[model samples]
Structure formats: C-alpha cells, structure tokens
Target: MLRKSLGALCAVLMCFSGLASAAEVPSEIKIGTLYASSGNYAGVSMAQYSGLKIWVDQKNAEGGVFVKPFNRKIPVQLVAYDDQSNTATAATLYNQLITQDKVDILAADFGSVLTSVAVPIARDHHMLLIDQTGSGATFFSKDNPYIVLTSLPMSSVWPKHVTAFLTREGPKLGIKRVALLYATNDFNGTQAAALRDAIKATNGAVELVYDNGVPTNTTSYTVTINTIAATDPDAVVALGYVNNDIAFLRNLQDSGTRFKWLFTIYPGLETEAVEKNVGAKGLEHVFTYLPSSVMAYKPEFGLSLSEFRAAWDARFPDGKVEFGFNSVAGYTTGLVLEKALAATDSLDQLALRKAIVGLSGKLKTIDGTFELDEATGAQIGETQPLGQIELDEHGHLRFVTVYPPELATGKPVYPAP
Candidate 1:
C-alpha cells in the first residue's frame, strides 16, 4: 500500500508540473501598427493595412514566428490604431501601445509626419521602432538610436533619377525653366532640399521660378496654381501627398494651366488615385517618378514580383495592386522583423536593434538586395525607373517605362504634342 501511494504521488506531481510548463508557453506576441485610415492619407494607409494583414494571416496560419529561445512559436497579434492623419493622435497612439497595450515591438506609421511623432516616443521608451513607410532623409538622423529606416529615403532616388533624366534630355526638350511646389510637411521639406540639389547637379539652367510650400489643410489651391502658371516653366515638379496632389491638379485644371512636364510626388503615381481623381484623360501624357517596384527589376530576391502582386491582389481585391510598392514595403518590413527575430531569438529592444542594423549583411528582401549605408544607416537599394502615364481605352492609367532603354516598356513621349 505504501509503495502504491508513493507511485500515485509521483504521478500527480509529474502531471501538475507538465500542466505548469504548458501554461508558461507564451500565447501571443503583440505588435502595434499605426496608420491613418480615416483622414487625409486614407487611400494609401488602407492599402498598407491590407498588405500587412495578408502577412499576419499567413504567419498565423504557419503558427506564427518561432521563438527559438523558448523553443516555441507565438502567434502575432497586431494592435492596430488609426491616427486619423493627425500627428498628435499618432503620438497618443504610440504612447498607449507602449505603455498600456505593451506590444513586443512597434511599427512607425505610414507617413513622415506621423513617424516624426512616433519615432521620438519610441526612443523615449527605449523600444525598437522600425520605419515602414516614412522615408524622409531627415528621419534617418544619427540621433535616434531606437529608430530604424528600412525603406529607401525619398532623397536617395528622387534627385538622382530626375538629374539623370534631365542631363540626357533637358536640352533636347528645351526644358530650361522649372517651377517647384511642396507640401509644408517634414517629408516634402526634405525632398525640396534634394530637388534643389538635383537642379544644381544638372547645371542645366533650370530656374526655381515659383517655389511654394502650402499648409497641410490648405483647401484652396487657386493662388498656388495661378503662381505656378504665371511662371510658365518648361517643367513643374510639385511634391505632395495624394490629397494635396489631387487638389493641386484640380486647381490647375480649373485655372487651365498646362506645363510640358509635371513631376508630382510619391503616391500620385499610384494607379488608384490616377484613375479616380486625375482621370485617364487628366493624367494622359504625364511623366511621374515612382519607386522601382512599378518599373520592374530582378535582383534575385527569394520572392518574385509576380508572387508579391498575386498575393496582394488575392488578399485585397478592391484595393489597387497597380503600384503596390507601399504594400510591398509594409510586407517587406514584416518579413524583415520576422527574420531579425529568428536571427536574434529575442524580442528585447537592444537585441532587435542590433539585429536590424546587421540586417544589410545577410538578408535579401523583396525590394532588392540592400545593406545599410554606414553614412546614413539607411538601407540603400537600386535606382527607380522613369515611367510615363497614359489612359487605356477604359480610362485607366497605364504605366509605361520610358527611360533607360534596357528597361523601356515604351518610348518616351515629350510635350504630348
């Protein structure tokens, strides 16, 4: 009887210990994604969120990221917060995610203005902050140790491509005069400086005839439009987000101002906005600078462009997969974070930061193979292609590669004459 009782006690103890161990398994790893889904940047932000969800869904299907140290996998749960396109709201969301939600890691918001606030807040809390969308060179300053810039800064590709295009074709087109416009925001300010630098580099006699930076909430663009029209420049380069770009274009249409070339910035090159707002007729024969993703390049990434496009469209059918660079950007960011965790085996901020900084050495991302630049600590990628836009028979914007004969999908159309 005594032997039997001892054996029963041992068995019970083993059962209890096993239960305890199972309970210790982490249920989930929390991550926070901040984006403006309701306000100004809603179009692009919504697309970004959709792309992120696809990655999250797939990862969860695979039982989430494997935490090597624990020898277990933990599902990733995103605590998404909408900033409503306000910087203050974004800052508050960052605080709440870090202090209350206690997410394992934090992602910088979709725009530079939003990231400007979130970056400092993450730095204050000593958390790892990966920049997913915001790409002003100013954000890549050496001061912010907690912040990591994963995308190619607007400065990196914007100026160089513009300069190269102009150097080869400026005199041919008689595009000597230039007008510049930018949004009164951090990202645009950084880009304006880069644009000026590009103009100087070309030494092609381009004049900054009309330079204006309008407030974010500027509703009426009549004055700005008239001023740009008065300049009568050969080329007009206006740098703004989607809304600002649309408004400026509408005002330009109202004012009946047409230029040889209009280099609108960033998301304007997106097919959705071009179709809905600019219209096929409105955007016809316009040249814009978009990221390399739209122009096509094969750099030996583990994944192909077609795979990325198919995955994106399958997830968000209503969303525009045309210029899915930002979506790819967000997805690439999530993958990089996963790889970093796998390599470091820890979610500790410092360990993750080190892993991120060391990413350039070993990782191959979908955007292209890139490593961190020692000078700016930003991931530098390949050059972007210059693409022109035209309307199809259905009034949809068709992006055609027009520069660098090697990647030319079609010939360049200048002056639209």
Candidate 2:
C-alpha cells in the first residue's frame, strides 16, 4: 500500500516537470505557489504575484537562503501555477505542485474558498503550507499539521472593529437602528455573523431592520436596496465582496436611498476600486475594516509602507495592485516562509515543518507580534483596523483611521444625512 501510494504521488509530480523549467538545481531550496492569475479572481492573483516577485527579487539579491541539503546558500525558486479561480482546478494544480513538482514548500491561495482546497492538498503530501490571504476560521479548527494562517481570521476580524466604531459614533450619529445585508457566500456570511455578534455584545439598540442574505452573483441590487430603505434604518451594513459591494452602493445612489452610515466588508470603502467607482459623493462617510494596521495608511508606518509599496509599484507598473489584503497577503507570506527557512540549515521537509510550528512559539510580523497556537492553527493577538474613505483635495482616495486612537487620524463621522 505504501509503495502504491508513493508511486502514485511520484507520477503526479512527474506531470509537473513536463512544463517546468529544465534549469539545473543550483541549490535545493524550491517552493511552489498556486493562485488564480486568470479567470474570475485575476485581480487578486496578479497583485499577490507582484508582492511575491518583490520578495523573490530581494532574497536573490541578498544571495539566497542557506539550504541544509545543499550545505550552502541557494537561491529560492518558486514553481507557480495559475489555478484560474476554479476550486477544482486549484486543487489539481496544487496537487501537481506538491506531489509532482516536489516543491520544498507550498504557499496557499488568496481567498477562503480557494484556500479550502489548497490546504488539504498540502497536508496530504506533508508540505508546509503558509497561508497569507485565506482567513476562514475552519482552516484553524481543522486537524491539519502542515498549515499556518498568517492573516487575520474572519471569525474575529470585523465584529470588534465595527462594534467599537459604532459604540463611539453611534450616539454622535444618532444611530438607533441599522440593517444588515450580506451575500450568501462564505465571505459575506462570515462578516455578517461577526457584525451581528458585535451589535449584540455592545448592548446597543441598533435594530437589525433588515437581516437578509442575497444570492452570491445577483446582478440587480435595486430590490435589496429598496427593501432595506423601506425599513428606515439609521445605518446599512452590507457584507459583500467587491462586485456585491459596488452593486449595492451604485444601486442605493441610483435609487437615492440615503443613509447615515454604510458599513461594508471585503473590498469596501477603503479600496481604490470602491473609491473610484463609488466616488467620494457616493461613499463620503462609509466605514470599512482592514485585517491589519497597515491598511490605515498611517504615516507612522509610512517609512515601511512606502518602501514596500515602492518596490511593488516598480515591478507592477501597470497599476495592477490588489487594494486590500491581496498584496499584504503575498508580501507577508513570503516573510513568514523566509523566517521559517532561516531557522533551519536545510531544505528538508521535516526541518521546514519544525521551523513553521516553531513559529507558533513566537509569532511576529511587520504588522505586530502574534502567536500561532500550537494546538490550534489560529494566530493569537492580532486585530483588525477600522478605516473610512473620503476624497482628498486632490480627488485621490484617502484612508482615514477611526479606531485605536494611537493610529487614528480622524474621528468617526456617522449618520450622514
């Protein structure tokens, strides 16, 4: 049975070699990346690729990583494939990378659904998978040994930020009631649940005038907007992806259904896409949450953010940046893998695993110090930052912080009439 399984795995690996570069291995430090560079989520994958490329360039410039197997420093090589935004396709691509490509390490995809398939594939082949973008809580709960979640988990991502913002600005904005709208997708459902739980915890009398879920790809958001408008809530929170968020925002403006506050999830008011399409007039006082403090656009971290963004912009001059978590996900994932690799003298799979799990003992990133629980894959002590979008005098999108006063640039202005 063992022989058969090994044989099957080896066969899968060989398939990857067909298209892979025939270049000789200068050293044994090779890693694999799987993402949707085409198809539905190309925007996300391209941004991630840009960030990864920056790190790769930097590492190579520094003379690469020390590989135990090679007994010398070796440049890290990544065998990346485009999963094309299809879950099944992503799974197969990842399997080929792990079982066939024989990549020493694996990097997961950008979102929850994509990562769901990538995680198990990595575990099956005993490759250490570092997740920079996926945030579903299920990844943390599952009994997987070869996985590390490097971003803010959704289960606790938005609730606290939203609740704190509301508590601070609710009375000021005269917000007594609100509506919750979400898409019936994993991303929206997770955010909606977090918002609901937050509202409950705060003891705020914000009535959930409309608690409803819409189909994921519903084109027309007019009915949804009209329904929520009819409730006369002081605020409306739409938990959605970029498409859904933009649809609802445009629909609300077209119908002229005004609200004091418009809370959103995913690529909400903070992103360049939302700002450009929704416009300043459309989202003057909307609130959005980002997974880390970096999203606040704080000048305190200006030095670091500027350096990183400059590096990315240099490589991706086509203005193909992934606005919110995508670039951060890819950039941070590279950092995590580098850290794990540095602890060991070798590229051996088992040694790499020890370095990763060893990370659980002390989790630190440019974002902040957090820990990966040994028992649970969850990263502890990480929190999301709250932000609001408004146009600057130059008409460029500006991100203003509204929570954690130490990092906040402006106070929350709610109940916009």
Candidate 3:
C-alpha cells in the first residue's frame, strides 16, 4: 500500500515538471535587425528588410514557426531600426537590440560596410549575428563563432571564377593586359587583393597595368577612366557597389573610352538598379557575378525562386524595394532562423549556434546550397559564377553564364564590339 502511494506521488511530480517546461516557453520570438533608409546602401538595405518581413508575415499567418524545445509553434516579433547608413549609428542600435530589446535573434544590415560594425558587438554580447550579405574575409576568424554568413560567400572566395577566366580562358581570348579598379572598402578591397594575387601567380601569363583603389563615395570617374584608357589594357575590372558602378559606367560611356573587355559587380547582382541608371547599351557585353535572382537553383527548403519572386511582387506592388540578390538574401536569413529554431534544444545562444552549424551543408535554399565553414561560420557554398550581359532583340537585358563550363548557359563574347 505504501509503494502504491509513492508511485502516485512520483507521477504527480513528473506531470508538474512537464507543465513547468511548457510554461517556460516564451509567447513570441523577438528578431532584431537594422536597415538603411537613406544612404549609399539604402536601396539594397531596404530590399533585404522587405524580404525578411515576407518570411515573418508568412510564418505568422500559418500560426507561427515550430520550436523544438517547446514542441509547439511560437509567433515571431520583429524589432527593427534604421541606421541611416552610418556605421556609428548601426553600432549603437546593435547594442540596443541585445541589451535593451533583448531580441532572441540578432541580424545585421545589408552589406559588408554596415555588417562590419555588428560583428564585434554581437561577439562581445555573446549573440549570434545572422549576417545577411556581409562577405568580408576579415570578419570571419576561427576564434569567433558568434557570427554566420547566410547569403553570399566570403569576399575572397568570390573572385574564384573571375581569376580562372582571366588566367586560363583570358589568354585564349587575346586578353593579356588587365586593369583593376575597386572601391576602397572591405567588400571590394578584399576582392581586389584576391584578384591581384591570382593574376600575379600567373607569372607573366597576365599583367596588371593600372591597379588603383578609389574612395567608395567617389562618383566622378572620368579622370580615372582616362587614366585606365592610357594603359591600353585589354580588360578593365571595376569592382564597386551599385553607386560606384553606375558612376564609373556612366563616366566610361560619356568619355567614349572603351576597353576590349569590361567587368563590374553590380550589373548582375543589382540588375534593375544598375540597368535603370546605366542603359542597356552601357551594360551590354559587361562581365559580372551571375546572381541567384536570375539563375534558379533547385532548393530543398523554403520557397522556390519563381514562387518567392511572385510573393515579393504581391507584397511590394509599389516597387519601392527592388527584387534582387539582396532581397533573396534577406529571405534566406529568415529561413536559416526558422530551421534553427525547429532543431534547437533550447533558446540559449550557443544552442542556437549549434543548431545552425548542424544545418551547414544540408540546408539548400533558393540562394543555393547553404554550406558553412564550421570553425568560422562563414559561408563556403553558393559561389558566384561568371556571366556576361547581352541585350536581346527586344533591347531587354539578359544574363549569359559564360565561365565554369558545367553551368555555362552560353559562350562569352570577348572584345565588346
């Protein structure tokens, strides 16, 4: 009789413990992020912010996302701020997200320049930064596991295809002399260094005639174009952001000084923005990184490219934010969070990091295969392939994947006529 009484007591205690665990689950998951409303990074920043919103809204509509620890769905609450494109402002806001709002998830802004400020802050606070598009090489180190790059590969890895084409295919196309021009920022600076090292490793197979770095804010490039023209380089590689590319291309067009081959970053990444500022004729025959916004990658998780694009249009009919690579990046960040939450054992920051790391090579999204360097949390998959822009018969712009034969959609048109 005493034994039976003890068993009943134990059952009651277990039931209460289970109830306590369930009660500990928070009512909502707070996701904190920042966006630039007005500045050089404004266009891409807003696009990314809109993409994240799409995910949050979609999940809430379906009765919230599943949390494994609680074994139940919990609604997401987004806590966001505008940094106005200032790094100092971003630093303060990042701290506020952790200490003040106490967000469960902390995400950075659009690109490297903005994301740079959040890296150390997140680390100092022991929060995992969901880096959306900042791909600077310096940002990732073995010592810091407090960050993860979700959308783009590291900046140093970005020029892999570009270097291959320059060293191997470039010689075949009669491209000997090359000129390198880039914005002096973390994003373009690292790429310039990588490209320089790759070209130099060729041992005179290719030569850099005029290599220069200009301030990121410099809009006028007529003098720079003239300088590069004097070098008579067969190819001119201009690495910069949307504004820099637009100004450089416009200057090149106005000066009527054309290199045999020209390459720029934004023509494909921010297609609509670049195309709108620089006409079809300006971007024609330009080489760029073929963005996932145009190239469809079969995803194992989340919405497909076409489906996400349709949803973006429906939500943003006014077209204030352009749908491009950054837009896809923002949504990709949300997908990572969703998967992490579903697999995490608890809400502890380190637990969330472990859950995300476990998803490294397995999670394939619209952005491409989501793989990470386990030590540094830097993205290693979803590489950017080389592509060239060509105007169709209708004068509409189209991308032709040229390099990396396995994924090549069409041959490259060397020596722009």
Candidate 4:
C-alpha cells in the first residue's frame, strides 16, 4: 500500500513539470524571415541572411531581448526558409510563415523583387515588417504603418546622387549626350525614369541620345551594344541585374566600343561578383551608387564594416563575401529591429510599429542616417554615395568614393581609362 502511494505521487510531479516547461516556451521572441539560399539570388541573399542570423545569435547569447511586459528576459527563436530565388516560391513560403509557423515578427528577403511580395502579406496579417533591401517606391505609396525601411531610399531616387554628380560634373568635360538602357521590371523602370528626370538637373546641358527598355530574360547584349554604339553618346548608363551587367560589359569590351563614362545599376554597388567576372581591366573607371560599402566607416552606430567582413570571412571561409550595399542592408535591418524591440518591450504588433515611427533622425547606422516618412513609409534621411571602380596602387580593384565631395576617397577618373 505504501509503495502504490509513492508511485502515484511521482506521476503527479512529472505532469506538473511538463506543464511548467510549456508555459516558458510560449514567452519566447519569435522572428521569421525568408531568403534565397540556393538559386540565382543566393549569391546576394546568403550574405544578407547571415547578417540577421548573426544578430540573433548575439542577442540570444545575451539572454535574448528584455521584455518589460513579461517582467523577464526571453530568448529569440529565428525561423527561416529558403525561397529558392523564385517569386512563387517566396509567396508560398510567406504563407507558411504566417499560417503554419505563426511567427511573431516578419522580416523581408534580399532585394526589391522578393520584398514586394511580402509587403501585401504583412499588411493583410497586420504584422510589422522589418524591411531589408526592398526599396521600391510603390510599397510606400499606400498606407502601411507596419513597415519600416532601413536600407537605401525609395527606388525612384536611388540614382539621385549619381545623377547629380553627372549633372554638376559633366559640363566640365563638355559631356552633352547620354544613353540609358534599363530592364522592364519595376526596379529598373523606376531608375530609368529617375535618370530621365535627372537630365533636367543639367538644365539642357545634357540630352538623352538613346533610351531603351529590354526584356529581363535577354541572354545577350551583342545587339544592344551595337545599337548604343550607333548613338555615340558621351556617356552610357545601364539599369540591370548582375547577369545583364556582365553581358553589357562583355559586349562593350569585345566590340571595342568605348564611352567617356559607363555607369550601371547593379554589379558595381550591389554585388562583388562583377569584379570577379569582368576582370580588373574590364571594370576600371566604372561608376555606381553604393548604399554602404565595407570600405566606409561610421562610428556612431557601433558597427564596424571591416570587422563584419572579417567575421563573415572567418565563419564562412568558402562563401563569397557578396559584400556590397545589400550586405549592409542585411546587417542594418537587424540593428533597426533590435532597437524597435527594446523600445516597445512587447510583442504587440501595434506597439512595435509605433516604436519604429518614433525612431527617426535619432538612429544613425553604418549605412548612414535612417529616417522614415511615417505617412508614406518611405526612407528619406539616407543618401546614396557614388563609388568609382579603380585599381589601387597594388593593382587590386576597389570601389572608391568620388562624388559628393564630402565622401570623396579620391579624385574622379573619367572616360574609363
């Protein structure tokens, strides 16, 4: 009889302990994000994804984010998915994150294309969006209080700095003719429109000699280069993806057609793959707008661009740095999210978003100043830094800041010398 009583008591204690553990699991901070880990976009998305993962690792190590409402610190659980670089795949994964995984916070993927898909979903779910690198202007045109951009400005203004540089500096070299080739997608289309408007900055000093919109699927730029060469513009600009940029440069090189200035949207400021594929001589004197480079340093944010690169190098020795504007966006997204979480100290979606709106000019990052137009959800404070691709004294190619006099690393080299 005594033995039977003892077994019953032991069983009751085990049931109570199991219930206690379940209660603790519900209080954790859950962060959900998706990225292209194994496709055309993987080269870029993996770098950005690493930034967020690293942040989560650091926070959890420090006992996760402190929550005032819970009256105790809670660890973070990062739930991520591989989108395979397909729009359809990303959309499906987003639904899973919302319905199946039921994550508390939703973060965006690598670039504008992928992020565009998540904007609507975040609004429908009334979830706060910690936007990564999706800077399209369309997302901000509507009412979406649950979103905050931490990297780059609206897509329409991405080329503002580079355009201003050409407008203010082009006249000195008698540059009067320009050519523009862009992809048909929203990102490139917006940039093309901005370039057209940027012409007014020159006050008729520079005119568009060639403007063309090519389909995104084009595999070769042989005919495109021949078409542009016929215009004989003083300078050439292209708004395209990595592959497009590579094709454009290759045809221009093989055809022996040269221009005074050649600037492109990607493969320069957005990714390091261009340097490897185009070779040093092919990329010399090219120009692009860098949202943030591992080359530049900003101390106010307590983030080190060089150190981040070194850490990435050490952790993933075989992985490509892919270090560029988007990589900075990835890391900065974590910083922005961390601040907002602490400011609210609650998982309530509305409270989290309110904290982000309240955090404007007050936040300075390695990427530059971060301020949002609360109404439009547009990023207004950050400005683009124009970078020139040049060979250093040691003959290694580097993106050196040239425009905006304030951020100039070296004198500008024109005509692709």
Candidate 5:
C-alpha cells in the first residue's frame, strides 16, 4: 500500500512539472519592426511591409506558426511603426521596440539607409535584427552576430556577375569604356565602389571613363547625362534607388542622348514603379539585376513565385503599393523567421540567431537558395544574374537573362537599337 502511494505521488509531481512548462509558453510572439510610409523609401518600404503582413495573416489563419521552444503554435502579433523614411526617426523607434515594447523579434525596414541605424542599436541591445533587404557590405562583419540579412545578397557580392559581364563579354561587344554613376548612400555606393574596384582589377580589360556619386535625393540628371555623354562611354551603369533611376531615365530620354548600353537597378527590382515613371520605351534595352521576382526558383518552402504573386494581387487589390523584388524580399523575411522559430530551442536572442544560422544553406524559399556567410551572417546565395529588359510584341515588358551563359534565356541585343 505504501509503494502504491509513492508511485501516485511521483506521477502527480510529473504532471505538475509538465503543467509548469506549458504555462511558460507565451500566448503570442511579438515581432516589432519599422516601415517608411513617406519619403524616398516609402514605395519599396510599403510593398515589403505588405508582403510581410500577408505572411503573418496567412499563418494566423492557419492557427499561427509552430514555435518549437513552446512546443506549440503561437500567434504572431506584428508590432510595427512608421519611420517616415528618416534614419533619426528609425533609430528612436528601434530603441522603443527593444527597451519599451520588449518584442520577441526585431526586424528592420527596407534598404540600407533605414537599416544602417538599426545595426548598432540591435547589437547594443543584444537583439537579433532580421534585416530584410539592407545589402550594404559594411553592415556585415565577423564580430556582429546580432544581425542577419534574410533577403538580398550583400552589396559587394552583387557585382560579381556584373563585373564578369563587363570584362569577359563587354570587350567582345566593343564595350571597353564604361561610365559608372551611383547614389552616395550605403547600398548604391557600395555597389559602385565594388564595380569600380573590379574594373580596375582587370588591368585595362575594361575601364570606367566616367564615375561619379550623386546625392541620393538628386532628382535632376540632365547635366549628369550631358557630362556622361561627353565621355562617350560605350556603357553607362547607373546605380540608384527607384526615384533616381526614374529621374535619370526620364532626363536621358528627354535629352535624346542614348548610350549603346545602359544599366540601372530599379527597372528590374521595381519594374512597375520604374515603368510607370519612365515609360516602357525608356526601360527597353536597359540592363539590370534579374531579381527573383522574375525568376522561377524552385522553392523548398513557402509559396512559389506565381502563387505568391497571385496571393499578392488578391491581398492588394487596389494596388497602392507596387509588386516587385522588395515585396518578395519582405515575404522571404517572414519565411525565415517562421523556420527559425520552429527550430530554435528557446526565445533567447542568440539562440534565435543560431537557429537562423543553422538554416543558412538548407532553407530554400521564393527568394531562391537561402544561404548565408556564417561568420558575418551575410546572405551569399540568391544571386542577382544580369538581364536585359525588352518589350514584347503585345507591348508588355519581359526579362531576358543575358549573362552567365548557364542561366542565359536569350542573347543580349547589343548596341541596343
């Protein structure tokens, strides 16, 4: 009779322990982030924000996301604030999210400029920053474990295919002289610097005849175009945000001065916005980084490209925000977070980072192969292949992957008429 009593007591104690562990699980995961509703980053920021919201909504409808630490699915509450595209505002809000809101996860806004301020802040707070598209090379370093770029490759790596095209194929196409123009911000500036260094390393295989950095807000490019025209560059590479590209393309078209080859970032990244601003004629024959928005990378997780686009259109029927690469980037961020939460042993910041690191080479999503440089937490996979835009017979725009022979969909129309 005493032995039976002892067994009952032991069973009761185990049940209580299990109850205590179950009680420790929070009702919801708080994901705090910033978004720009106004200013230069607004368009891209909102699109990315929308994509993330779609993920959150989809997961909530399916009874929330599975979180391994709790051993149960927990609904996510996205605690977001509008930074208005100001770094100062973003810094203050980032601090609020960490110190005041005490969110479980911290995510950055769009692009490098807004994300730059969050890097040091996240590090200071010992929080893991889920960087969506801030691909600035300087943002990643071996010592910083508090940040992970989920969407885009680091800016330095972005120019690999670009440099290869210029050096290997450019000379054959009579593209020896190149002109480089970029905004003086982290994202564009790093890319410009990388391209310049790569060209210089070629030892005269290809050279930059004109290279200059304009302010990110520089809207007028008439004088700049004339200056570049005087250089008689065989190719002109303009690296800037959406606004800069739109303005430059517009000015170039107005000036009736055309280079044999022209490359810009946003025509492919933010196709709808750029085409709406610059028109299809201006975008035709333009070279750009063929983003995952246009590529059909087989995803091992989450929605495929076409399915995601359909979901995007369904969610954003009014179309206030343009659908583009940044939109895909935002959704990709959520997918990474979901997978990390499912694999992490605990909600501790470093533990979360470890979970994300473990997923580096294994996670494949709509954004292509999700891999990272473990040392720096920089995204190394999901490369940006070179492509050229061409208008279809029905007057619609389409991408033609032209460089890196293996992925080439069609030959580039050199000396574009």
Candidate 6:
C-alpha cells in the first residue's frame, strides 16, 4: 500500500529547476518552518506545510537541484518545529530558525498571526521570507523588503470582489442591514476594515449594522450573535478560517438565527471534510469568497486546477487530509524560491531577497500571477470571485461561483431558502 501511494504522486510534473552559476549549491538546502503541530489549527497547518514538502520531495526525487557553479545537484531538507499554536512560541522559534538552527531558508506557518512573527525576523536578518499563507494588509504597509505572499491575496483586496457584489446586489434584495463578523486577528482584522470601507462606498444602499471581531479560538457565538440578531441584519458577512467558519455556522444553526444571505471567509467549502462537518443543510445558501476551484481557476505553473485536484486526490486517497488550493499555494512557495535561487545562483539571504523582488511580475505559478508592487511588498496578482452554496439541478449541495459574471459558474441566490 505504501509503495503504491508513493508511486502515484510521481506524476512527471515539471520541477522549478535551473542551474545556478555562482555560489556552490550545497549537498542540501535547509528550509526551516514553525507551525502548529498540536493545537486547534494544527491539522490545517500540517496539510499546508505538506504542500511545501511535496515540492521538495519531488525535486529530490528528480536528482536534486542542479547548480552549475558547484557542478552538482543539491537536495532539500525541511526542519520543522511545532509552534503548538502559540504566537509567542512561533516568535521564539523564528529566532531559533535564524540563529540557533541557522537554516538557509525560512517558510512561514499557516495564517496571519503565525506568519506575522517571521516578518520582523526576516527583515532584521535581511533574509527573504517566502510567505506561504499570511495575507494581512498591515504587513505590506511598511515596505518590508524581506517578505512576500505566495498563496493568498493581500488582505486589502480580499473583500473587494465580495463587497462589490453586495453593493450592487443588496439594494435589489432589500438587504439594507448587513453585519460583519470576523476573527480578532491580523488577517480578519484587515478583512473587517476592508469590508467596512467597501460598504461605506455604497452610498447608504447597505447599512453596516453590527461589526464584531471575536477571538480565533472562541466557539460560542451567543453574545455576538445576539448583538448581530438585534440589528436584524439582512446579510451577515463573516471573516473566519476553517475552525471559525465551522463553529459560527453550527452556532448560528443552534441559535435558530438564519440570515437572508450569509457570507464567510475560508470556510473550507472546497474540501469535503468541512461539508461533512457542517452538513449540507447547515451550509445551504452560504456565500463566501471563491478564488479557485470554482470554475474560474486558470491553468498555470505545471498543472491546471483539475489536474492539481487529481494529483492531491492521488497523493492522499484516504480523504483524511485533503486541502483546497492552499496545498498548491504551499507548492507555489517552493516555486518562488526555486526561481529566485536560480536567478541569483546564491543562497545568501540578501542576494535571494533582491532576486525575488526583481522577479516580481516575472513569476507565474499554480496560484496565479506573482507580481508585487515593489512600493508595498504585497502581492496584487489575483482577484477572488464570490461564491454561494446551493443545490444543483441534481439537488446536491455544491459551491457555485456567483459574482464577477465573467468567471461565475451560477447566479447569486438571494434570500437563500
């Protein structure tokens, strides 16, 4: 069984490889990571980290990365530590990655809070931070030269498409009162700020009634839901991760509080695990952001959306650890590093950073374009399309892209019944 599983993933996809003509590529490159290996978000983090490992393993299997300067190929090594879902521990571990472990490369954990810990350390050490997941808006404001997002869009632009859809469609449905609920962290904080600004621009067509940011670990939503309910919001927009989305939806069901329209962030709708957890009835008519795997996904890097999905299914056929496009996001991180390392032909932190920023707009991968406005180290490559969960003609629940007509797979269902 193990042999069969390993052989299935050897799908002849192109490895991001090129010869570096300058510094000698060592026998192996050490990539260090700090993620929640045993906490609330540990499972999600583990799956995300696996994306990076997938790419590294593939490269090693292909006889490592060739470096013309060294006249040899160098394999990659991953040195990961369990942050235990603590931000403070992540910070300390990052310092260890830089000093004690002395890793040549650093990979971010899973979300905004954990990734934020590495931004300062990378900048201070002048090492390139190949951000795999974090996309908080504030992180890009400082002109940080050491970090760049690989998978998700900058938080500043995350709410743009969804908010635009609401502004244009809300008045038609009498959705005057809208509530924004988010996790009280950098990722969701920035999302709430953006949503507020987007709604403000609608010129009173949609009223921003209840806006709240709750803790990331808080499962009970009675107090917040009550406040939200009092406003009688027509639509409730939530910015949460997998756990937050699950808890919020379940609590909303238990409280018997149903909104005409529902939207949440990163609900894991693309993964069946989330569907099984929330159940089809609980998830019916919920709207959220759909960046990929929603019918608008474009082919890039070495794989298309469908092809990538097949690859993931093949690798983890047990259905125990399936991830959405984020697995591709992690793989894209490795692609960026490979591009920069080859361009600079050196692993020296400063040199790699310069190489990466210079390759802005030049890099393209499975996630989308990799362009960064040098002025703000934020990636403005891809845009998301709003999606809603609805029953298809077959009467089976499925997430359909609704907004941005060009990429939409189906029309938006208002007052979801």
Order the candidates by lDDT, highest first. 5, 3, 4, 6, 1, 2
- Which one is best on lDDT? 5
lDDT of 3 at 189: 96
In angstroms, how far off is 168's CA in candidate 1? 4.8
- Whichever of 2 and 5 has more lDDT, that candidate is 5
Q: lDDT per residue, candidate 6, 81-148, as tens digits?
A: 99988889998999888889889889889878889878888888887787877888777755677787
* Decreasing TM-score order of the candidates: 5, 3, 4, 6, 1, 2
TM-score: the better of candidates 3 and 6: 3
Model 2 regions lying over 4 Å from their true place:
1-26, 67-72, 167-173, 201-204, 266-270, 291-303, 321-324, 345-354, 357-366
- Model 5 agreement with the true structure over 2-38: per-residue lDDT tens digits: 9999999999999999899878989899999999999
Cα deviation of 153 in candidate 2 (Å)?
3.4
lDDT of each: 0.71, 0.68, 0.93, 0.78, 0.94, 0.76
The clash numbers for all candidates, in the given order, read 0, 4, 0, 0, 0, 0
Q: Report the alpha-carbon TM-score of model 4 versus the true structure.
A: 0.89
Residue 300's C-alpha lDDT in candidate 1? 53
Candidate 4 wrongly placed segments (more than 4 Å) = 1-26, 200-203
Q: For candidate 1, lDDT tens digit of each residue in 315-380?
A: 767654334566766766777777777766467887787777777756666665556664445666
Residue 325, candidate 4: alpha-carbon lDDT: 64
Q: Per-residue lDDT for 168-263 in model 4, tens only?
A: 888787777899999877678888888898896667898899999998656588888889989988888888877678778877778887878889
Any runs in candidate 5 off by more than 4 Å, and if so which?
A: 1-16
**Runs of candidate 3 exceeding 4 Å displacement:** 1-19
Compute each candidate's TM-score over C-alphas: 0.85, 0.83, 0.97, 0.89, 0.97, 0.88
